[model samples]
Target: MESSKSASDEGTETASKVEVKQDEFSYLEREFTSELFKLEINNLGIFGIGDFKKMLKSLEIDAAKVKTPHKRDCAFICLKSKEALDEAIKKLTGYVWKGKTLSVKIARPNADPYIKRKNEEQQEDSNKKVKRTVESQTVPLAHLTYDQQLEEKDKEMRKVLTAFGNNLRKLNPSFKLRKDEIPCEFEKIKPSPKIDDYRNKSEFAIGRNSNNEIVVGFRVGSYSDGSVEVGEIAKLPHIPSKVKEAVLKFQDFVRQSKFLPFNPEFNSGHFRQLMVRYSEFSKEIMLVPGMYSNNLTEDDVTELKQSLKDFYSDGEGNLVDVDSLYYQHLGKRETGEMFNPVDHLCGKTHITDVIHGLSFRVSPLAFFQVNTAGAEVLYQSIIDLSEPKENTTVLDICCGTGTIGLCFAKYCKNVVGVEIIPDAIEDAKFNAEQNKINNCKFHVGNSDDYIQSMVKEVVYGTLKKEDLDLVAILDPPRSGLHKKSISAVRSALDLKKIIYVACNPKAAERNWLDLCKPESKTYKGDPFRPKKAIAVDMFPHTSHTELVMLLER
Candidate 1:
């Protein structure tokens, strides 16, 4: 009887091991067969999770789960069956959803641990390659012959220009290059005048460096790895020396003080970010100190304010003269409110900068071009490309501080500048008044809303569309214009020319594509074709270059 019981126990153990093995095999198979699709929805304007689900439902796409990893513009859908996934892709790909193009493709199987490991290894290898390339380029060309160095530099410049042209072509295949009214095989690349110290503003974060010492500088790498490097401002050529000195002094003061550097992981400490803005025209400096107000007493605030005043005062350790100083209370919330409840700590409340003979009042939070010299070149190009006539009315969308529109106000009949930031609009108005410019009108609102209202006014006969030759200038943020803005532009019948100034070519390429696409449901009117485009080297020593394209029907 005992022998029989032992045999039964051994049999039970063997069955349990077999069951575990079978479950493991089943999981592996499931990973291999996971039906997931990724959709790169272009011009996904203000789309939330509910909107995405509704769109999927309208298309009869059955998604088990939906994930928006990055921005609301892209979505990942997990379908129950491969057939459903393929059908969804077929129906949505190349289709205009929300007036934007959709790109659908099968997502890589991420359920498999092996696949994740392989991807991580591949990323590390790519990073190593980039590091090696950068290191190789850092070797001074002074060792080579002068002529050889010149040849190498020219070769590198040509390579960059060619790559830029190729990317633009890929983004818009229908776009043709023009050289003196003749179609050219290659687009032109313009060089910037000043390369070093081009940036007018620099923001530094307070953190513990690799040496485990509290420092105020730009972050080098991922914060999770705790690989912050200190005193990097000295190496950056774009940052002015005066700004760097101020940052260094501030770093020292903060380190010596009782206040600690803010740790994002632990959410402790007081110091957050230090912003320095320098004016090339006025030669003035503006300092903005961002700090968290949570867990701070009245005495703590007073002490902090006194410390800042003492640091900037004419004392033994005074690094640079701060023309303006502002204290901003940064909250932990992710809202549109930037620098809530700002207080003027010392000196002036704003700085001044001159662009194309017009002085602009720049608030601490107002959006102004960091590259002051490059901005002059950019504005000149825009004016030349726009060709504003005496009777022409210019519509400047996303006009920060009304610099571009004010420049054109002297040449054009009327200039309407629209900006979303209220402070920027205020600055614009102040600039207009200071400059005694009456032809320009600055509006504080969203570009889309203002554009729609203008279209309505024209339709209602309140504003005669033909009375003034309308020329629209768009200088949107890095994300480019929303689909609604594009639609509003199309709806305007009297818009003769469009001058699109884009800092980020990749994002702007989509807008260009949409504008140039053949007449469809989203775009009912005749499509605008790119007449001329010039690359402005606003940011030198970097791969980024601003492209200004002129489009007309």
Candidate 2:
């Protein structure tokens, strides 16, 4: 009886290990066979999964999908064989059903279902594990020379910009632009000053490695993909040695601590994220440790913060000079988590970054360029392309810490910078004062709300609106500007030239169209012309490039 009990306990341990390795889909007991196909019906709002089966039966296809909610437009169905899949695709695609065209094809597996805990992001389609592995390479195109990468980027941008120009022509016949003028030239594709170890900031995830031990590094896959394995980032070329060393040391400290790394799947534990910002000029480093506050007393929290300070200030983590330390108690990554409540744990509250010979104070939440050296090259290109004279007033919109505006404030007549974040505005004002730049004025408000009135006040009070040259510098976020904001910028007649800095050109395409589109009730201003555009490689070893588009009326 004793031997049987021991064998039963050993079997239970083996089963638990098997359960740990199972993914989200494994719980559903999904049949991932080749015969499994997803069927999507047209007009599912009126006729849902119930009607989908009826239509399939009418076509003599004996396949039926899994039972789903009443309003589901799509579902996974199992067909007989390969022959049935081909026949179903042939018949269902473009077929008229319920006065709507029915579309059907072989559907890839669904992504991880959205978990409602933190509600940070919807699931990413992790259907193709093989494809995800290839895409996770640090530099998929690193084999190509820098010039070759630039050439490849140029080819892609040329096509995109030319296509946008074509769209402009189609919208208004009066629009006139030569194909050469669409994008400045292939020569204008600016290269980064320093490619490797160029990143000044990195946010390392706090999660378990394959061995289930706490690790400080990049996630092997996204949280939404049901893969939360954290692995070392030593292979990445863009990270500096100082930053890497700090990460390794911090990892050691965390592993030794009594607290456990936060588990997103289980929503329990302490540490969450480690965000490090290193300055190339000042050589100052700011560390903000992000963590989930749960199952810990007030004393526990105090002790944890003290331990971190002691470790970095005098203990093992003292290998690197830690300028500033911040504690970010982000309970959960909820939707609309705009401003993080960061407590200045110890040391200096702000780190200074010198760009274009001007020192700018960066707060824990301020938006500074990740690549400092590359930003200098990009800023110089912007100044060269825009040609702001002594009489020109640069209306810097979405100005974060006033980096772009302050860089060229000496050249321009004056800079009227606007930003939404109050902390960033304060830093911008401080930076201006520290640098003894009195000509510039920074405002704390939405750019769209203040732009039209601000332009009228600055121009009417100082110089004639017609005589003064006004240029608008738009550097909106990845989601791009709202329609109302675009309309507001257009309404200002004094603003003749627009230098749009697009971090995500694809997402920014709508704003570009709104600016250059024919003057309408919705657009509400003189249409601007796309004079020239250029790509700046701000992020190396990635598929992204910053587009600087110069538009004038």
Candidate 3:
């Protein structure tokens, strides 16, 4: 009986250990969120490699490669087999692998049983080291008053302004930049008044309060042609006048100081504004009224009541209230998960000379340039390279708000735009009608669908080309060309030139290969091949870069 009891206790202990091991940690130990994982995966697949087929396509990498190995939780999964890892990668990349042989090298963090060995050696080294005979006292540089700092900053700003102005003017005689043209951590710079749209807006400024040490604000705008305009500067009446004056002086000082010679390493916000002041400035600018305001109207109240009543009072009944209906409609317009209205007012778009001559409003979902000047450069590049003329009938695929097609419409005899987003198509139609551009027409449907049906019909002669030469411009989503889109474009036998504007190089690269591949048929002539490529810095800060690849048959 004693021996049987001992055996039972041993079995229980073993089971408990196994359970602890299984529950303690996750199989996939990745630190990044699944959303970010998907983004990185999608970004990588955007740029396809031509040399490799689907199997090798899985090896493509993106900016996510910078992630630390330690952050990879999946590494700890103890995958059932190497095949499992390959399968996961294949699914993530949207590729297939039919290779026969697979080889993997395993790296061990610690090979030998040498625990505490380094600790013993470190102890011996600590004993050998002794304290120095003398210790030096810490000392800070001369303390500066607010006035002194402001004066010094102004002097520096003037010097930098002179240099920048000279260099810019030398490059282009028409070049000019305003105070707001340059931005910093404290305040933002905007288009100067010299530009017609921003002439009335005020200059932007930021500084700290003297008494309680809070941030103050001002607005500034600048034009590329070197015009600066100041807008109505508002300050909360609660702060002291002295602090207000100090803050204003500091802003000017900072602006002027920017022009002066300074090391990038030594540059920091602390030298000008207090850290707390900077934080307050950021909060003031970034915090939206939508986050805190509860300004509900009577109509909103009525709608809320009606909605509740309809939801609970009846199995199926409708309540009709005009005010409630209006409020509901407004609410739907203002907010939704899939569509963001805020982005329409302020979003990333490249506005170039190609678009400057044309008038249009970008759709909330459509892609455009955030920097108007930079966009001019990009558009001009496209125009110069594309050479869209009177004889050409340009087909702008994924046209968005018809910016590209409309721009070419004036020069080309006719322009046909196809886009996926209905709102975008509406905006494009409105833009064309508003601009009195009768030559361009926009259609609302998925570009892939439009190409498959409409383009196929046109190529087959059921629909008319109306012109001899076809010049195509495709600015697709980050995913590049869909299979259907590729087939449709290729079928356009009349198409002589294709301009592919890709925001993501990886995805576009893949689509480019698909177009040039032998499997792609020629409806009118030979296969399409890349003629030349140009890189544009549409997004300056991040790893992202835009590519324009010209393809000719």
Candidate 4:
């Protein structure tokens, strides 16, 4: 009987051990599938792993691991917990790091490797399906008929605009969007008159083509794939023929020389990128050649510059007009200062473009609308929406080159423009002077700083708020206005109207939500209600549309 009892006890102990093991397994599964969260970071350009970690540290986020899949300009970060992941996204999403605005979103559960290799197999299958579809439609883009291309473009625009409208309504439930005023529903997208070769600016990447030939074009997929397609400019409908010719010639010159294309994986090559900007109105062209020059000596750079000058000189190979030329040296650093001194290789230092009867001088690094003609239509839409009074003070935020603010100078009593880039402010002043407009002032500072200062001046009686009607015009970057700037606008009780223009509707919706919130710690004044919104199809073919929202207290 004692022997029987001993055997029974041993069996019970074994079962207890198995139960504990099962409980531990279940806990780990729950931890991974529910407690942890994954985030995908988009538009992460040239940001190294160290920089990404620093960003998370700044936001007080503890990430489990960060992965760069296929060496793309994106990062997948696994956080310790879902709450921490949410906090990191709240602070870092739409944050501009190194001139690239980041878009962060919650990644799928399959993004985690804890689920074994099933997710990887599924992803491979999906990619194969997509590749097959693309291969089936391998016909050259140029062969497509104009009407067919327009139809495809129109369909894409309609889908994107519809999504924008939906996002706006979802974000601001109390604010009513005038259905009749929505441009996408009421007015047809204004197709680009010059559909073929309409782009004024094109930036090309230097790499080895699929045939392993030295080429200057765009990458076919992620950088890790190491596959590039040469002569894409020649096939693309949006690139100008002249620009294509210049790029082809430059590629030939590079092939003849000993310089190598920049290898992003190894970060060891010389040539990097090329930018071409042309103005059809002024008939002027600007060429900027970017190179990784930390390893290159002074003599090598000088020889390269001379080679460029000889190639574009008035003698043998006058590929393009060669109006302006600049060589930019890109250093090996992860910062906003991407370019070194601008070495003027030949011709003028700047180019000019006429917009709405105003001749604006555009520097190599300055920001200008890619579609100059379409910009006129967009600016007119802003004006029509705002309808600035004669005795109004227009505050232009993120005023690049002061074009929008200067446009309002003629109608308003005073125009004050604020831009973060000092060079852009100088350009704005120069533009104002060139146009013989003296009622405008451009300040080099953050929009929020300048707005708060102006508000303080009015409160202290240095500036009279009652003398002029206040109208704010915001043309922020694709990331939209900063939270502080939005708060400053709300605090300015005297401001009567705000015209917010945005290229990315998603980012704009976030700002609009903050503006329309009933009560917030940042904003003290009454919430500004969305009065009207209109979509402008500034980009015809692509899935992008400019939106202008008018708000009032």
Candidate 5:
């Protein structure tokens, strides 16, 4: 009986090892070709306890519903010996043993080795077409003349100085105003509020403005003499005791009410001391009868009507959809995309065809160009410079909602988009589906990880060759690409072109150095280098600028 028990125990151990190997094989197979694996399992697999456990482990089947690049639900599978893995899958799943080549499906839709390899062979031909065109083109910089540049610089300095003088005059009434109204210098501005009482040792105080609005702030140190001073003002300081009690009661009512937008004035100690909450005061001023009597358009008027409906609704309150109006107006006007919430109200749509034949809806949290018209020009420039074709396969990195990729898709064979934000990925997918665009695919996750793992996996794990050609369009954040991301792109053997878009030039320069470095792995064997550069005036009145560089191998 003891000998029989030992044999049974040995049999159990053998079963456990088989189960473990099957589980690992299932995982790798699913990771590489999930859809194909599922098809095989469902049509061929025999029911067993081990098979059920394998199904339980592959929860990623559901997670792939929203395929954000960084958060892709697929795993890395080494496909060096496809036959071994295929045989194992067939045995475990009881499927027909046919030696069909495995392929990537959902993880990278429409990504095929044949097409990518074909693109590699034809890259030289494409480069020949663009070489003369790009090399012969010279960007005009005549607008930045030396005298005009100096004049512009002087004007900016004067404007800043004038604003400083006005602030200083408000702080100190007896600072001796300039005769010619010359602007105040940085050194001339006071550090704190001025006060007549020299004995007061407190650091700060509040004051009322000419409009009887509370403006309580005081400075401790002076700019000229390094002296300390205080300024204070009271709005309705001499209210009757009965009126004060009534005001306090009214404040309590305002707090309990849910009809006000959050205003800093009400919560500030200086404003609260007067028993006049900011919301109550704003409503008393802004919510007056016939306040929006401007010559608003029909759409504006409709928006106002909707606003009134929301304001008066007793249930299901929603924050006024500020961004929707902005985009709608911009789209109608054919102008650039606008992002500022305040712009939604007064911003007039400029009639132009800048964004003609193109439309995109941005996610609330996504970072996009705030000035709509400027963005149109920027995107137009990208479209013009990219020179996308039916044969080109575009890869848009940091693709928010895949706008650029989708725009290029109608002209390109395929557009693969990558974004880190899940919501942005959703927007991209929705946009693609809405347009009935099958050539464009979006995934969520860090671009660096996707490039390092997914790109290589698709290339070597499946393609087994690094001779393919790829174009990487990088629109990294102001902080630019992480170090790992730089290394991945640098090491990629198939990349033929890289379009670097930077909101911050300084950060761009840093990444550029990393890419251009002779010793860096990214630049080792290839002769690819930054061939062209362009600057876009994203913000007209600000120091911020957008720079784009084209790199080619």
Candidate 6:
């Protein structure tokens, strides 16, 4: 007998046919990269990434990497040069496979799709007789009043939630979602208390501005939009003046420093990115400057760090009023967790903040909501939705910094939080002690990997109670929990309730479907019924918002 392969082994192996994605070229001014080309094999829907790689190898093409934008019909071959791309297309075109005459053609790549968009925007602007600047490109809604922005965001969220409910209905049609049987309605979206300058975190890219000078700020557009030019975010409505000041101060320092800003195309230079975390509660700011040493020596790295320290402490960098300074070494991976160990150079190691009268230490890896004031509102909404009583035990899943669990612990009998990141669990544990909260018990591991056992522990083991009830408070990242975690929650009839706090509710609809779907052999326990739903406008002047929903048996 052989063991079955886990989901991680195959890398995004799914049963769905043709995972369609929005055209990346729709955005104006994206990163410029022509080194790689895509080959859209019309009949390759049956093939996986492994098959694509093997097929390329069989063709005797020396490509560096093969990736798909989750499209089964397309394969992106990352080659060294134009000659290599031409060679790959030349070899693979019109190749026969699996009783089909394969017609492989050049396809749209995510890297460079902006030339047309830029031209169109330019043409549109010329026709309208209006000139658009980088500020417009970065934050288009910045010109709108705060109230107007909130109204626009609410409209966007209404559209998003409608699509979200449709996904739920499509997945499990047997169970009526948002119909009479399933009670669900979108409450009024709460506005951020502090509309302007509400962003607590900003990751500024170190790149050249229009003047081609080394600058520290946000990109004019997203990378997928083929944008590489970093622009000043000083006028961005969401960015705090203090954070903007820090960006300008760093820009000046980088301009004068001997080191150069990191180039994504060339992959050279030392200074890469600057991450700022400002805590409204603590009135403290943590600065983490990112750099790569691919072109530097140990002595060079030490010299750069020392210069940064001196600049912030006594030089012009002091204008931003730096409270904490840290350094992060860069890694090669382009996306997903792109950071090495963060070294604390000086001042506070963490940005301490209080929510719901409880203090939490936000570490470099720990996740926190960008809007501090809105987080309080969101937490309160979740509490109000769940209505945790004295005999309740809250199982906080993916509890970062233990804010959500700790927030509930004060009302519930006890809260048991499980998080994969050790740093996050440590912060949760420390927060529990700091706030004199002893009911919280957090474990560090992949939530799905260990959640079943913990769920069993709470349901059939020590935490089980006759009078007490178990409710799961899921606040997973945008990429929701593994299906097994959803099944784990659904497997236990004793776990009666789920209060899901989603930054991206659209992504969480799948989990919601699994929880509410009729129980089968695969899904072993009784399903939960969808109840009240509330939306929080954590991000103002932006389309993003937070959602809190209650699900019970």
Top candidate, metric lDDT: 2
Task: Report the lDDT tens digits of candidate 3 across residue range 480-524.
Answer: 877668877776666768998877765565666556555323332
On residues 1-553, what C-alpha lDDT tens digit does candidate 2 reach at each position? 1132343344334324533222433322433343355554443446655576787789887673454545565555666576777787788778787787776656654533433211322233345334333226455556678888888877777777877767766776676655534533434678888888888888999977766666898887766644677888777778898898889888998888877677655455678899999987888889999877645577778988999999988898878888999998876445566666788878899988888888989998888888898899878878887899988888888999999999988899889999999899999999999999987888988876888877887778664546688888899998899877888878887778989998888888889989888888878779887777778988787667888888898
Error of 1 at 303 (Å): 3.9
TM-score of each prediction: 0.70, 0.76, 0.41, 0.70, 0.41, 0.78
lDDT of 5 by residue, 1-553 (tens): 1132343344334324422112212223323443332322232122333333354245222211122223332232222244544543444443232332322321223233332332443544655542211111111122454344334534543453344345444433454556334322211111111111111111112222223322322322221221112222212221122333333332332233321211111111111122111111111101111111122356654654455344333222222211121111111122342322212222121111112254444443454454444555566656665776655667788998676787677776677778888767887787778677798888888888887554554355334243444567889989999877777887776666788877776556667656654544334535345555555555432344565667665
The residue-by-residue lDDT of candidate 1 on 77-141, one tens digit each, is: 77777677778778888878777788876775444343333335454655464321211222244
Better of 1 and 5 by TM-score: 1
Q: List the global CA lDDT of all models.
A: 0.70, 0.76, 0.43, 0.70, 0.43, 0.74
Task: Kindly list the per-residue Cα lDDT of model 6 for residues 1-553, writing each as its tens digit.
Answer: 0111231122112222243343445322332244335455566656766666777788887766666766466556666667777887777677776666676676665533444454345446456654435667656776788778777877766776676666667666765666323247678778778888888898989987666666788777654443567777767888888888888888888878867776553344567899999987777888999887655677777988899899998898877788999988885545455336678887777889877788889998788888888888999998888888887788888988888888888788888888877788899999889999888899987777766776677766544366758788999989787787887788776788899888887788777778877788768887786788888888776666787889898
* Rank order (by lDDT, best first): 2, 6, 4, 1, 5, 3
> Model 4 Cα RMSD, Å?
15.3
Full-model lDDT, candidate 3? 0.43
Using TM-score as the measure, name the better of candidate 3 and candidate 6. Answer: 6
Q: Which stretches of candidate 1 lie over 4 Å from their true place?
A: 1-50, 53-66, 69-187, 223-231, 294-299, 314-319, 334-341, 455-466
Q: Is candidate 4 or candidate 6 better by lDDT?
A: 6
lDDT, candidate 4, 1-553, per-residue tens: 1132343344334324422112212324523343258888899887667778897788787787888877689988887776888788888788888898989988764422222222243446554643311112222334556556555645644554455556556555555654422322334445444655556777788866644566777655543232223334455656677887778877887777666676543345677888899988887888898988876788888888888888789543475677998898887554565336568888997788887899888877766777787788778877887887777778888888888888888888888888887767888899999999998988888887889776554345425546657778888889988888988888777776888887886667678767767656678687777666666655544446676778888
Per candidate, the number of residue pairs that clash is 0, 0, 43, 0, 16, 5
Looking at model 2, residue 111 earns an lDDT score of 37
Candidate 2 residue 38 Cα shift, in angstroms, is 24
Q: By TM-score, who's the top model here?
A: 6
Pick the winner on TM-score between candidates 5 and 6.
6
| Model 6 lDDT, residue 498, Cα | 92
Model 1 lDDT, full chain set: 0.70
